[model samples]
Target: MSMKLLAGSLIAAALTLAWGSPGLAGPARPLLLAQASQSAEDIFWQSVQNSTDPAMFQAYLDQVANGTFKGVYKPLAEIKLRALGKTAAPATPAPETTAQDRTTPPPATEPATPPPTQTAQDAASSPDIEACDRAAAHAMDDQKPANLPGVTFDKLDTSAAITACLRATKLADAPSREFFQLGRSYDKAGNYKEAMVAYKAAMEKGHKRAIYNVATGLMKTQRGVKKDPAAALALMERAVDEKVMFALSGLGDYYRLGVGGRRNYPKAIDYYNQAIAAGDSQGYVGLAIMTYDGTGIPRNRNKACDLWQKGSSLGDSNAADYSKRYCRYR
Candidate 1:
């Protein structure tokens, strides 16, 4: 887990269940973070012992932004790290200016690589590809509910936020999570090549989340990446070890499809169960499909119907469509 993530979870855990109660205008919210602690144990105690206050942690994070840990506080921001772009890194680092920060800007330029089986032109024109891309982008949209927890458009003020993000990550003392954030920024800007650089750097620094994300990007054939199921599966497994639910679902998909490995229906079922235990909706849909097909497990229409109903309730469109075909409306 990233230190930034640990910090946020720790702070939220510090909240008084009875928030907005008397004496909580601001000051009485949380303050132990006002003073940095000596040890990791104390740090946890200090964080959880205080009230829920993002500002306190934000200030604490700012002060330690360039500290030894390279801690960053963003949660679920890295995404869409496509492999369809430039082959070369920039000659120099971007200036510490806010304006150049990552945003949903226009495509700066396309890489010079020759068109593949599926060119950008083709992808743009193909309704299926366009819809898939839209779904991907929509998942990361900060504006509405994707029904995916721990994900949000936390950096709405792109310029200032990216400035802070870059400044923090640029410090020789900065954490790998900072680079993960940088990759997310670049990904948001549609700079897939640059995003990959940041992801690689984060992975080098042992960021499991970055490994997970790079793996997902590699698996997206529509993203112009050469398929590397084995490599992607390996990375997802690593992230799953860190107890990331996203990685668990990824493993389920990889196992079911035999991507980067042999088709193991049983393993896929297990991974999907793990994700479902972690409250991920994707698991319900995956498990439902496999049960319906009877690929690995016995075909049980009743069980599959029940799973599809659960998944559809969780907002999985595929499960909803499948329900219409194979099972009566729930």
Candidate 2:
């Protein structure tokens, strides 16, 4: 599926989810302030890479005009707009204050004390973040790209993870990754609404793994998020571009199931093969299904059973069940 940015309202809505409201960060204000620079760069690049639509860059410029992505991405977005043969609308000038208004005395109040500044360590090194990582971090998360054998959903401590991640996300200097973990924690607990909120927040901050999660977990009928399989497919593709290797399996499923478009068996097989090559056991299950059904390849029960056995050995429950039920691979 070709990636495209949604309407500006939707984009802004997603950003609103991240900050709790437009122009207001609520309790997470300090956290957003702390990571603003990196988040802006990440969000800008991700949005730009996912689509070439001029409106995309325009939307970014609009965000900048409205008080986000001020320094770095603003110029870059303008440059992109120029390259695309479009020009950003000029900044709206502030209304000039009249001499009479300046002469009027404002109500008197006590002098305000500035709030204490928070450092990145306040959240990065937080014990709650550590607990969240220990309790719910997915093996395939980009944050731990090198660690591919972490706890599975069934083994996740949903309660503990949710508590810790929730605490971490509220910290004054929390990173976006904590929001991703919070989403995972809610997913494990069967709280789709909360999970969707957390995943969208993480996605807004440019968490690649959260992109995959939002595509697969939320962008479908009957999920907490409104159904939009086309958008989901686009997001999955973006995840692949971002080198979320596990997303290959997701693309395979999308193709095999014809969720966003017509079934393309060849594409499904190709994605599954790529995922398998990347050492994702879930890929084995997808290929096994195709082999067993003779969808794109010749029917080969033995080959399917072998594939399921391999996936089962890699800790995939669906593969284990299939292996046990058909292959007698106890």
Candidate 3:
């Protein structure tokens, strides 16, 4: 299926529950309200118990937003959001900054020679590199969600990760994925120059996420790399074609922020929605910021709150902060 059609189907599937009827009525209102109140309490505590999983918190917000229950748990939800990431901002900015300080890309360099693929047989013959993978794995890795725990860029322990990844890279059975993780470690550690080298190495081995990282470097014009928004956007388009989920959101940001020297609100919204459909919660955060600011979209504080609430539920701290700061429920 095409990306757009696929996105539409996925979006429809995601909203299936959201669009369902609550089944409240005059005769059953009292009993239903009591049931809903209990359900809300149960869900809120459940989210608190599994605070590590943002989806739990999102469930509670979903209930409240959909009118299944009163928003009594909102305050506690805000607390959870704060604990998960940075403190809430005092006020909303006009345009949310797309520049990620921790994961900024470095200059492109000579590509590393591709190593032999680490097949299952090779891995079985060598010492397990699970420790290195655990230390350096990134949340944005398209291949990691099912096999490993992914850490956010800001949350990474760069020192430990870098050491593990460096050791992993020296192994004869090391694969392209290790180099990508090593680049992520360096980027998070603010060693963009080294990060670029590792990313190029990963790229030479056909690591798709490395392409996104290189494109980001070109977009941000930091890390000793010359600015090339056009090149960055082109690379992102290619990454999207290669099924890199992060590239979907990255494209949304580019159009949203005029990174390519021209803002395209319609294109931005399309990309953001597509990203959200693809299960990238950052898409919700970007769209919510645009909604809050009324930039190329109708200004709807409530809609923005709903968007942030969804993004927060998906483990985005920035989304949680925005929802906390702006999603005031009466």
Each candidate's TM vs. the true structure?
Answer: 0.47, 0.62, 0.58
Using lDDT as the measure, name the better of candidate 1 and candidate 3. 3
- For model 3, residues 9-61, the per-residue Cα lDDT tens digits are 43343333333334554232233443343343443353253344344455555
Q: Write the per-residue lDDT of candidate 1 for residues 1-330, one digit (tens) a residue.
A: 444566556544433321222354544443343332233323433453232333334434443454522332222121101111212232455577466555547677977887456444443345433222222222422321244332233433343334445444544444555566666665765546556767789789876677877887777553224567778888888888876556888899999998887899889999999988987777888898888788798988789899878978978777788888889743
The model with the greater lDDT, 1 or 2, is: 2
Question: 1 or 2: which has the higher TM-score?
Answer: 2
How many residue pairs clash in model 2? 0
Sorted on lDDT, highest at the top, how do the candidates line up? 2, 3, 1
| Candidate 1 global TM-score | 0.47
Please report how far candidate 2 places residue 78 from its true position, in Å. Answer: 48
> Taking the tens digit of each residue's C-alpha lDDT, what string does model 2 give over 118-210?
788766777877777777777767564243355678888876677677767877867788899889877876667668889989989878889
Best by the lDDT measure: 2
Arranged by TM-score with the best first, the candidates are: 2, 3, 1
* Model number with the top TM-score: 2
Candidate 2, residue 262: how far the Cα is off, in Å: 0.5
Evaluate residue 130 in candidate 2 and report its C-alpha lDDT on the 0 to 100 scale: 77
